[model samples]
Target: MEQESASGLSGRAGNAEPVAQTPTPDGAQIHEDYLARARRGSIWQMLAIALSLAIAAFSIYVLGRAVSAVSLSALRQAIAATSAEQIASAALLTVWSFLALTGYDGLALRQLNARVRYKTTALASFTSYAISFTLGFPLITAGTVRYWIYSQAGLTASKVASLTVIAGVTFWFGMAFVLGAGLAFHASAISAINHFYPLINALIGVSVLGAILAYLVWVTIRHRHISIKGFQLELPGLGLSLGQIALGVIDQCAAAGVLYVLLPSHAELDFFTFAATYVFACILGVLSNAPGGIGVFEAAMLKAVPVASEEALLASLVLFRVIYYLVPFLFALAFLGAHEGFHRWTSLREAMRGSEEEKVLEDEINPLRRWYRDNWRLRR
Candidate 1:
């Protein structure tokens, strides 16, 4: 490669292509493959960001209309009606949910051929999800947080990118798993979509499950990486795939339960029934990229549970948001502050240690000079 570069620039200066280049399978220069893929990914990411913003705006506008019709006094009464046991139960479920989320980063690290201490992985995972869950752009919010933590720990930007992609796939696997089971087992549970056609809902559930199975079987058979644009999904060993699915299932269910537990006691909703609506609403929220899926999630939830009184239902939604979205967001900010403080303290300590070592060396080699320097500083 150096020989060709020199030959092309041999005693001349011009915008000349390299006289020699390695041809790729598609006949483009080998370097072009990387460039092409990067460009493709960048374009797609920009388009997605634009679409998410639009959806969020539209959702918020629609939600404003729905909210205007509800009685504020009744909503307040409904919130007051909630029991301490329910709030405690819901918050405990949130802890379990975040614990499962930590596993996502660990599994992604395994898939991306990287490793970090469990504590570091937990910090990154929790901070990212806590922020991104409210902020709505995981790529920007969660991806940046992961890069900051993982890069400092020695992983490169490219590997962190792959890790984020894998973590996201893990989420999908769980969502699909839960959705399929709920739909297949109890198509009538989801009040939002069941009214359209129960049979169709079950069929959709089957298709979702079938697709997940197909992916696992295909990867096992092919035994090759799946690459698209600039990203590659490394085919994990069968055990890792199963573990990812489990993590997703647990994480998704626990998160759903956080909101589910807040519903009025008399509401005719079972876990499976509420979870199906919850998952679907959560999907809409994610796709909208609305902050905390605020307007979008409430709209979907209210639409699904029309049987419930609006005032009581609205209060439950408000409490659910406080528990699942707002609280974690504030806590994540606190964690970030503490992390920064510790990092700064460590840096200061290391700097002081280096200075002390230098002073000690001077005193050993030239005691008089060291003494004078210290006395001068003290005098100053």
Candidate 2:
């Protein structure tokens, strides 16, 4: 009987099904491919970071060498020679530039169909640009600032990101337009600084302008959307696109004007020519990935603009840094701090008010509780 029971148990166990331990060939291959792609993405990211670092380091070295040529005493003399009128003009232009920057956010808000107030849009735009301008990585810094402010206004994370991207596009449109116009009209002037032939510069300028025109026509015809990593971005219509181009040009020109006013009166460079040089220098500085384009911008300016007074040029660059980059950065920091403090205070006040109301209710309920207790005791 024991032998028969053991055999029956063995047969039952054998009939029970078991799942396979190994994955199918196709499944295994898919997983391996996914891992390979991930590895490649990581490698590419590392390479990009390394390249940025290298460019920044090299630009800094160049800046250091350029500064060594000008004497501190001469620089001081040059700065002292600058008229109060010029300083005032530069300051005014700085304000104008920042104002135009606010329009970038405003336009982005319109594109997103987010009905945030004008004040909120200005705050988000100005603070983000101020912070990002001084910090090197605009994408991260600007996006964070926008998200922080816009989230309170009910903007989703993706919407904030789209806003940031749209704002960036506005800036590029302005930059490309100015650069192209300057190059096309005054290629000879630019060629003197960049060493490119006039014909080539003109061709490049024409190509850029053509591209912008084509984009404008395309958007005018119908709605256009671009998909990036599963995120869909709708392009603005013709009117909005025109507004972007205008704002961009104004902003870029104003920013460039800040430096232009600081240049020596004897520099002999016209506004259009100087603007192109300034834009080119800015592009190089941006590419270097240094904070505020610090070392790179100064180096490029020194190389491109032919100033008779090197000391004056150096002094102008120094003042430009202070007026444009440093002042805004400090102001943004203070504003952010004050904004956070005020928000906290408001929240605390509301919380305290709620707690007081709760205490008053509890106090009123205490008398009723005592009355009920007495009645129940008497009845018992």
Best by lDDT: 2
Writing each residue's lDDT as its tens digit, candidate 2 over 94-191 gives 99999999999998888888899998888888889999999968999999998998998899999999998899999999989999999999999999
lDDT of 2: 0.89
Candidate closest to the true structure, highest TM-score: 2
Worst 10 residues of 2 by lDDT: 262-271
Considering summed lDDT, which 10 consecutive residues are worst modelled in model 1? Answer: 188-197
Q: Where in model 2 is the C-alpha error above 4 Å?
A: 1-58, 360-380
lDDT of model 1, residue 185 = 74
